[model samples]
Target: MPVIDQLRDSLGWDVVLTDDADRDARSHDTWPVATVWAKLGRHPHRPDAVVRASSVEDVVTTLRIAAQTGTPVTAWGLGSSVTGQPLPVAGGIVLDLAGLVSEPVLDEIDRTVTVAAGVRGSDLESWLGERGLTLNHSPQSLGRSTVGGWIATRATGQFSSRYGGIEDLVVGYQVVLADGTVADLGQRPRAAMGPDLKQLFLGSEGTLGVVTRVTCKVFAHPEHRVVEAFTLPDVEAGLTAMRQISQCGLRPFLVRFYDRDEAAHAVPHEEISAPVLFLGHEGLTSVATAEHAAATAIVASLGGTSMGAAPVDAWLSRRYDFSTVENLLAEPGGYAETVEVANVWSRLAPMYAELKQTLAPLATEVLGHFSHVYDQGSSLYMILLGRADDDETALARLEEIWARAMKVVVAHDGEISHHHGGGLARQPWVRESLGTGYPVLQKLKDGLDPAGLLNPGKLGFGRR
Candidate 1:
């Protein structure tokens, strides 16, 4: 109470939100499991106060005050964390960074955009589009997520194959630590630096520090764009096609192989009777031509039937629509979620089968799609759907699905999560995912946040 009064008096009374309505609104993310907890009035992790930070100075001051008082601070963006990363489970300060955006500075010569962290993805994209430039970072949550949240979560975009993920796009960032110290990390295109310190905070899910500004690589709008679609017999066959394409050194701007259940939602046509593949290319005309041709040849050799461009075009048009999850969440007995994991090609097929088989009994619809491919491996994004007669049963089903999927991910040598980041939902598995390296994270927590005050319970770092 004293800290709240102090913060209100010191940081401006308007910035501190102690009203019940305000705290209740900032309490959760897109996580349905957490939503269920809220519905049951089990908000044990709700924040004591929600602070609307107006600038980097505001962020620094709040962290200092919270640190001085031994309180946990969770950085909040658009609150779109599907993994519950933004939830202030330890009940301290939820630093809402949604209002801290500043004017974006674009460098035509360097092809980079320097902006504050509060800029939402859509706003950035629109600004770039006006200048015939693009960041090519289009995640499903683009419309709601802030640039800082993407860096914090280590998220992947749909066009990652050509443009790379957020980690690859970010040249540098400014992070405010637990003690109110600001560090500017990575300034050049490439550096001979020993270790990129910015990476320590990326995907740290607010456990390390609060990111405030970033400089990222951007691109001129693509001159050529190509789209292609195919129907594969099964997920294994689809994975094979994708793996071959990636291994052959062809980088398509978009590559998605969806299982039947998932395919139906994308195309929803009777002709698409099996698993489907959506492929595309965008960049120099020659590069697009070469990559698209090579990918088509690889998939055709694997017995994939060409399905024309209608389905792929359809997917592109509505890729960011999250209506399914939203609609389900609105229902009394419906639940759905997308969980993703990564593994090498050697274990890719088996891991996919194991995860689906384990989740099959608990779900009404289990769909799988592979994206964000690498030379050695790819990430699998699985959509799980289920229903019950009531909220209690639906919540139990949702929790069970996440629990089972996590076990399969660990048992099969897959990372607990590929792009979702380790939030409250994945906190317990973070240690196992890190193994011998887990202690390193703990040490980082101890050294950087000695008071255990920054996003205290995430990534299995710091005590709750």
Candidate 2:
């Protein structure tokens, strides 16, 4: 019998899907390339079968069968990855983990919540809110992305400056390795017991194993929040202020710096003639107030003009809205993609300029911004908007844009991706980006997934 039939026989028809529509739906993610493919009425390597796994036992059985048959398996959540991380590139079993859920268990005393991987981020936050607690993770896809997807992609949120990224938030995980071996890693708040095993799956993109459940740190909902906006003289001034604020140990929950072009769009007021900066602090009322005031002084010292709370408030109201890109991509010949890269403080500005200059010809508009910051550096988010005569041409332009952007980023010694995992989009440059680390990744993959069946063709593994 075929692999699909075997899956159906073992897991039942309800759990194993083989129809065209089911396979196609499980095939691609929200990758811009996939979006273009959708616009052109094409599928990017549909899976042979989609297993709607409802329990850990179901996952174990599917993986065991896959291992026995030497079939590939790609784990999927809500299909929200923009880098094609969930795409079933090698057509075997697409394990739909969204159906595999357990009620969230909150330990208020420990300030931790253990949730099934399929839990949507927004839903998780809402649950926490009702109890006067919060995960404080606010990704653009919060409404759609799941906990599994966040861990798989090493996701970060807008409030990452203060709360840290998924890597920092994750306390422990339940993972199912390739050969049906189940591992429950990370039991402590901190440990020196050899290397941290959970880190292996944080950004593995389902290549190493499947992340089924996660326990993350949570905090009491902020008692107060302070928002302040500034207009910097230029990118240099804005970055300098950001670096100082970060290095001085000020933990603002939010920081957004937009380049002139992006600022024009973000602020959209005639008085705004320079780069824009927005800072937000949240926590205990007194602490939030102090941080906000300190950050304000730094901005003022850097010649930043006060823009009050109006702009920041406006942004907070619609921070999660992604319809702009959605509507653009929905057009017949439209192309929009975001390339996010990061580097140390010294190299950030130059790399940002180089990327903008290099990618200028590839797209109609290249809007840049810095949202997530650390003491050492910050993530640069570049939004490319373009149009072509037809969908085919638009797809070609999208590919070209990514190619050029990656080349520029690598040349500058910057991370090819800050939060987005190495999906099909960044697969080609993974070797160069990881340098000596790439081989180590291969070794890990070999040891954990000798058959190379888990999420093949991603993170630079099992490439033909």
Candidate 3:
């Protein structure tokens, strides 16, 4: 019997899907290229079967069956991945984690919560809101992304300047390896005995193991919240203002600066505007007020005009859905693509100028937006758009633009990726980024999964 058939017979029939339509539907992730590729009958790639696993036993059974038959296994979350990280290349079982949703257990004493992998961020946030707690990790895909998917991709949210990424929030994790062995890491608050294994799976992108559950540190809901928007004369002034705020130790929960073009595209102010900066503050009522005052003083010193609460509130309300390409493509003769890069504070200004100069000639329209703030520096998410005769031509143009921009980023000592995981598209550059450490990771993969049966052709792994 085939692997899918045997698994269906072993587990319930409802848990396994082998229908052509079903397999095709679950194959690709939310890659923007899929919007064009699907119409051309060239879907990204599809797995042999889709397995909806409900419990840890279900995962163990699926992994064991795949291991016994030497079949590849790829885990799927809510299918919100933009990097094609969940694509099943070897035609085996696509283990959907959506069925593992379970009510979270809150340990108030420890200020942490243990949640099932399939839990959606919006769902968890609402559940925690009733109990006066919050995860403080709200990525742009919060409405659709699952907890496991976020951790698997090592996602950073808008509030990362204050709460940090999923890596920082993770206290412990339950993961099932390719060999059907379960490994639990860091149940205690802190450990100093050995290397941190939990960090390994936090951003493995399903190459290492399947995360079934996660224990994450949570914070009490802030008593007060304040948002401020400022219009700056130029991008450099905005960057300088943000750097000064960080240096002064204000630590605003959210701080983002958009270039003039991006500001026009997003906010579109007629009365008074140049580049724009959005800052959010949240904490105890008194503390939040103090931070807001500090931020106001800093913006004023940098020659920025404070637009007050209305624009900031509107921007916050619609921030998550604004950048989605689907929404942009809906407009007449409109299409959009985004690329992100990270650099140290000292290099960011020059890098930004160089990136703009490099892509401006090639792209019909280009804009840069600063998001995902950190203590050290910030990330730049660049948007590009153009007119094309067809989808393929449009994608080719975008790739050319990305290539030129990446060259400038590398020259400026910046990372090629900040929040987005390196999927098949970015695999070519993985060796360049990891250098000698790349081979060490490959050896680790060989030792754990010699057959290369776990999500082949990803993160620069498997036989060429």
lDDT of 3 by residue, 189-237 (tens): 6678788887887777888788999888889988899998889988888
lDDT of 1 at 420: 91
lDDT by candidate, in order shown: 0.87, 0.90, 0.81
What's the candidate order when arranged by decreasing TM-score?
Answer: 2, 1, 3
> Candidate 1 on 291-318: residue-level lDDT in tens?
8888899899888988788878888888
How many angstroms is residue 432 displaced in model 1 relative to the true structure, after the best TM-score fit?
1.0
TM-score on alpha carbons, each prediction = 0.98, 0.98, 0.94
Q: In model 2, what is the error at residue 367, expressed in angstroms?
A: 0.4
Candidate 1 TM-score to native: 0.98
The true-versus-predicted C-alpha distance at residue 16 of model 3, in Å, is 1.8
Between candidates 2 and 3, name the one with more favorable TM-score.
2
Question: Which sections of candidate 2 miss by over 4 Å?
Answer: 269-271
